[model samples]
Target chain A: MTTSREIRLKSRPVGLPQASNFELATVDLPAPGPDEVQVRNLWMSVDPYMRGRMYDRPSYVPPFQLGQALQGGAVGEVVASNDPDFKPGDIVSSMFGWREYYNASPKALAAGGLGAITKLDTHGIPPQAFLGVVGMPGLTAYVGLLRIAALKDGDVVFVSAAAGAVGSVVCQIAKLKGHTVIGSAGGPEKVAFLKSIGVDHVIDYKATPDVVAELAKVAPKGIDVYFENVGGVHLEAAINSARPFARFALCGMISQYNETGKPEGPPNIIQAVGKSLRLEGFIVSNHVDMFPQFAKDMAEWIKAGKITWKETVEEGVERAPDAFVKLFTGENLGKMLVKLA
Target chain B: MTTSREIRLKSRPVGLPQASNFELATVDLPAPGPDEVQVRNLWMSVDPYMRGRMYDRPSYVPPFQLGQALQGGAVGEVVASNDPDFKPGDIVSSMFGWREYYNASPKALAAGGLGAITKLDTHGIPPQAFLGVVGMPGLTAYVGLLRIAALKDGDVVFVSAAAGAVGSVVCQIAKLKGHTVIGSAGGPEKVAFLKSIGVDHVIDYKATPDVVAELAKVAPKGIDVYFENVGGVHLEAAINSARPFARFALCGMISQYNETGKPEGPPNIIQAVGKSLRLEGFIVSNHVDMFPQFAKDMAEWIKAGKITWKETVEEGVERAPDAFVKLFTGENLGKMLVKLA
Candidate 1:
């Protein structure tokens, strides 16, 4: 018998969740049943969607139960296994919770849990990269930009949360595609990080009094595809800057995730009619076909040194709660990682 | 030479326009210049879009001149022609104003003016029908419902302003394609008209307090395609009823046309993102290929007596202003028409 360190839901948060919303505890672990793999988690992914899991309301996925161990995407090594597909010593990733160890079911990723996807290939890149540039959010940016936005070369792209895991990848993809990429972030550091990734224009809406005026100067031709990672004021700004036939790809509403039940109604969709615009919302899991392509291309990009990434590591499973809370405040940069023994 | 009776703009209204906003006067017809055609107007279409012309702001089409004659689709016999494609006594339709006669420049309609497209056959259908049921609004319904919405047969369709010019035709087309069609109208009379055209379900939202609840009873599966001819409360209701992958074809915002500038925003577009919906706004003019197909199918529907239509005809060019305002009040049973000499 072994004990798995876990962080459970302690309280429902009002705004950007704090450490008080979670509780770090230990639970007795049962040995792996047949067709199950026992994993010793090394790193966990901190994402915006976790905010929804704490609420009781019906969302894309089920809400986490109070005092129950919360689960999401985590990279771990198989300490023991009874499954034919998974063997001991193999590094596997689970869309499971903030636990130091977990017993992952043999089923496909879809049935595993929230944010669960197909088995990821950690061939050329570091295992923690699966939590950052090679994981769900990265694939999300790729599919949302290339397929959903139907982005064309020279098309202008405007991404919200420009230095975020998904937004950072969106900026790089936009740059690689030869498009004029502009982004908005909270502070000077995040804005500077966006510029570091080859973003053509970065606006620290905090420093810039008029976001519209700044975007207008950088993107005189206007935005073609707006990759919306953050909602609220950023969305309002994108709406004002959108060009004719502009497309707003609704990927994440990170800014509005803390709202009681759904975000407040937007002021004008009627503008869509006049501009002949197309606004579509998409879930990353819906684009299943793109996974193989994402893997191949991402692997190639990493091998060719075409891409570089970062991880904000929080040591020990007890620190997972703090790492998760800091995600909302721009406290941690790049992909926030929770490392465990 | 007879003076043409024309309706010119007098003042822009604050909300719903009134008769005082128009100035009807008789003016001498100018002789046709080179590449010009003089047409004795037969039928001029007075549509909901004319309300936008009353404002000075830019729209998909140019704003209606404050002191100049407001124009729309009109079919008439050419009295004289200096252009090669048009001849005297030939039936032609172009962007002619509310007048008994108009001298149109080829530059007004570039390429070939009224002569560029096929003349109205008006065989099985009435010539006035060419201004409506088989005309601009019909094609608007077609493209918005079919091409942009990418409708699949048997999909549930919900239409707002269900008995108006555009909604009336859209319901019938959806029904013919084996779809379950639902509609919401202002009053019992209009709701009855919606059912007469083969809509499966009807909700008089003005009579029903909760639109979402009312739609929920009938559309347990939720709405797949929302043909939005009206926006506002109806738009909010549609968002709540929208199924995953719902498509909202925004052919018009007749609900907001009376406003001088940008209309107030609908409160439910954020739901559009949550539900993974696509909202597309377009004008029928952009989907021109549907014309020949529309002419063929509409003629067949007329010949087989597959269609029954109602017209609120305001006699003469003088009554165009009242007729236009009556539309905003839902006074018309089907299409609001203005007949000219």
Candidate 2:
């Protein structure tokens, strides 16, 4: 038997979630049944998107249920297996996060899901990297940039939340493609990180009184592609700074995730008609067909030292809530992870 | 020599345009230059989009200059021609409206413009129809629906300004394509007009206090396509009623055009991320290439009695300012035009 410590939703958050809204609970796990594989989680991810699921509202993904263990992307090792597909010592990834151990049929876990349980071919990369770069987050950046935005040659790219997992990857990819990249993030650390990744211009949104003016100052000619992660002022700024026929990939509006009341949208959205802008929102799961190509490209990039990632780790399952809440508070620099084992 | 009476932009409008912002002036039209044609305007259009030119900001089209005649779509009869491409009494269309008569080179008038001078076939249709249904407004509806919105099978279309030129066409096209269409406009006349055009559902936005709630009440299943001509509450309503992967064709923001100060945008725009919505803005000028296809389809539709139009005409060039101002006050229905010579 294995004793798994998992976080459960104590209550729904009204605005910004607090750690008290979650509770750490212990569960005893039995031996794997027929066709089931037992896993012991090593790392788990906490993303801004998860905040939407906490609302108990209808969305692309189902809302997280109360009194149940919160689920997310997790990389783990097989402890034991009754399924031929998974053997002991094999590394796997699943949606069985916020917990230390789990037992489920491999087929059942793989059913119609982006976070399907599958044995990892790490290829010398860290297993936790699957939780951020080279995994869902990496594919998100790729699809949003190359597909949604339809990035073309000579396009000037702008990304919000530049130091976050997806934004950082977007910055590096656009820079690698020989395009001028402008990045916006909160503080000095994120600004430095963006600069380190060769971002042509960095705007510390926290320091800038008006993001619209700052973006205009940096991109006097205006941007051609916008990767929208942070909404509100960032969205307004993008609309203001966009050149004719600019494309915006609406990845996530992290800034609006915690709002208790309806958030005000970009006031200058009227400019879209005159500017011929296209803003398209997407869920990464819908573009899983691009995973193989994304993985191949990402592998080559990593091998050539063209890619890098950052992680802010919380060392235990109990700290998972803190890790998640930190995302809203801007306490994490890049990917926020819970080291579960 | 011919005498031409034209409306000039005496001053840029601060808010909703007033008669004082425009002035009627007279000029003597000299003989046609080497390649020029002399023409007298028969019917000139006063559209909502013309309001954008009154601002001194850079846009897809140049801003209207102070003391210069305002330009728009006009149908005219050739009085004289210097080029072999045209002859006397031939009906032509040009971007030389708000004036009774003018002389210009056909080459110069057609230079890099959608509002270029071209002889109209009329196809047994009326000359005034060239300023509306078979012209720029009709093409605007065609491109916005088929191209920008990328309408597919079973899309429930929601259009704001449903009684307006572009929107009325959008409603008819969607209905003809076998989709359920919900139209929103102000007053009883527009509601009756929408029903006459076979719109499945109609919401009188002026009578409906909460547009979002009204949309939900009308389209309980949510909408897959939104033809956005009005911004503000209509945008919010569309966002609220959007189904997953809904597409919005941002044609114009008539509601925001007359605002002297910054206007508040849709408060629920952040919902776009979760709904996987796509909002694309377009200018008909940019999609001029589709004119031939649109013309063919429109001719067929008109012949089969599948299409119809309404016009609110003001007599004489002196009433042009009143006609233009009526757009903001929602006094004009469908195509608003001024009858000249």
Candidate 3:
């Protein structure tokens, strides 16, 4: 029997997720059925949004099925194929969950559209980027910035979680379009990291007490677009810095995700009406048509050495739970990825 | 010397204005300095927006000048004139501040714009209609309801301060456009008034403990457009009932004007982002082009008896301030006007 290491939900945790919230287990890979294929996961992605999945609550998508493997977008190779479309040695991607090996069928991830059995074409680019810079997180930043925020050239942009996967790319893309981009991270190192990647300005919220006053110092003209990756006080600062008719793109609210109780809401919504602002919430799946175009543009930027990124790779599949929990405490330097060996 | 009574701003009041705020003083008439005409005021209009004039703050319009007469649009007759454009005994509307008799010059209220001197036309409509049904209040309601709210033919519309001047016309216009209109007022009397004006639903917020729940019962489709006149709780309830992509026309927030302190803001502004709602603020001056069109439509609606309204006329200029205060307490019905004899 082939052995596979996996991380499973131990118990639904309240507030911040800790070590005891996750449990590691070993399981045998089942023989593939007529239409199923066996996937051997190589690279697994860990994201802040996964914290929402850990809890048993309704969101845009369903919560994690407790005692089941924690699933996420994964890049892997098919070990054996029973389906005619997918053959052995074909590189594929699926929400394969947090496991080293699994028996997956077309019904598991692909239900006819951009299905689970995607042909991973490296096209000479780094493959890990598909999990971060060019995958869901990348598209999240790109689609939200362009469609929802209506980003224009020379417009100023501010992103929360500025050094994180999606936020870092948002800063770079806004910069490529000739807009001034500012980013905020919790500590000094990440702030420096964002600055190194050509971010026009960086503010470590730990050092700045008054976000509105601080943003005024950086973007005296006020923010034209706000890429919201974190919510709460950061949201208030962004809202206050917004000029008339400014657009805000809501991708995620990481700050409120781990809270045990309901967090305080913004009380200055009248400013939105006064400033004639528009704030829109969006999901990456809604804009799938732009992927082919995005892949082309991003590939060119990478070739010209204009685009760069960093990934904090946690070694071993058994340590995946540790890597997932480290994201909450800001231990991640860039896109946090778990490499299965 | 000609005798003309006026309410002069002797001093700015600390809070809710009192008699001490005004000084009724008569001075010798200064003869028309070139291009000036003397007006014998026939009727004056009292409005809620006038409250902004009482404060010393920067707003869309300049605040009332201290130690000077309160300025507003007044309908009167040009009793004496030296300008070639005007003749004696010609009825005109001028921004002739708070006084029974005043002089208008080329450099008057608007200096070089429409407000300098507006000759009243009797297009089979009463001159008083210029202040009520077809004037600033009516125009405000029309512009806000149509341009900002974009009220659809079958859309459900909820207007606050339904018994007030602007809101009364909004409901009539909305009803004529085939909308299921709902309105909120303070008491049963005003509730019945809304029903008389063809509002499909009326909620007496005074009788209901939970306005959001009451609105849910009456407006099953959820409010598509909210014509916000009195803000505060009504605004909160509107936010709760706001349909996805709902439109809010924030014309005024009279409910918070006389508040002892800053009124607590709405609790569910994030719902705006969640539902992709659009809230816009507007003034009638921005939509002056609609006058000739509104003049025709309003006249047609009035002739067909499809639109009806109410006005609480306070006779004598001395009662104008009292009538103005009545609005804050929801005491007056329909448009509030002052008749000078």
DockQ of all candidate complexes: 0.55, 0.89, 0.29
DockQ winner, 1 or 2: 2
TM-score of 3: 0.83
DockQ value for model 1: 0.55
For candidate 2, list the clashing residue pairs, or say none: none
lDDT of 2 by residue, A46-98 (tens): 99999988988888888999999999999999999998878899999998999
Q: What does the interface RMSD come to for each candidate? A: 2.6, 0.8, 3.6
Per-residue lDDT of candidate 3, residues A17-122 (tens digit) = 8778888899987788878888888899998878877767534457887787888878888888888888888777777758998787875557645436676888
| Chain B TM, per prediction | 0.91, 0.98, 0.94
* lDDT of candidate 1 over B1-341, digit per residue (tens): 65888988889877998888899988987688888888888887778877776778767677877888888777788888898877888776676748789887655566643234335556646777777788887878888888989899668999998888888888888887889999988888888788778899999987898887888888998999999878877787788889989999987777887665655465556666667899887867677877789878877776776666778888899988888888888888778877787
Runs of candidate 1 with Cα error greater than 4 angstroms are A11-20, A107-121, A261-263, B31-36, B81-89, B105-118, B260-264
Question: What would the C-alpha RMSD of candidate 1 be, to one decimal place?
Answer: 2.7
Best by DockQ: 2
The TM-score leader among the candidates is: 2
The order of the candidates by DockQ, greatest first, is 2, 1, 3
C-alpha displacement of B85 in model 2, angstroms? 2.5
- Kept native contacts, as fractions per model, are 0.65, 0.91, 0.19
- Summing lDDT over every window of 10 consecutive residues in candidate 3 chain B, give the lowest-scoring window: B106-115
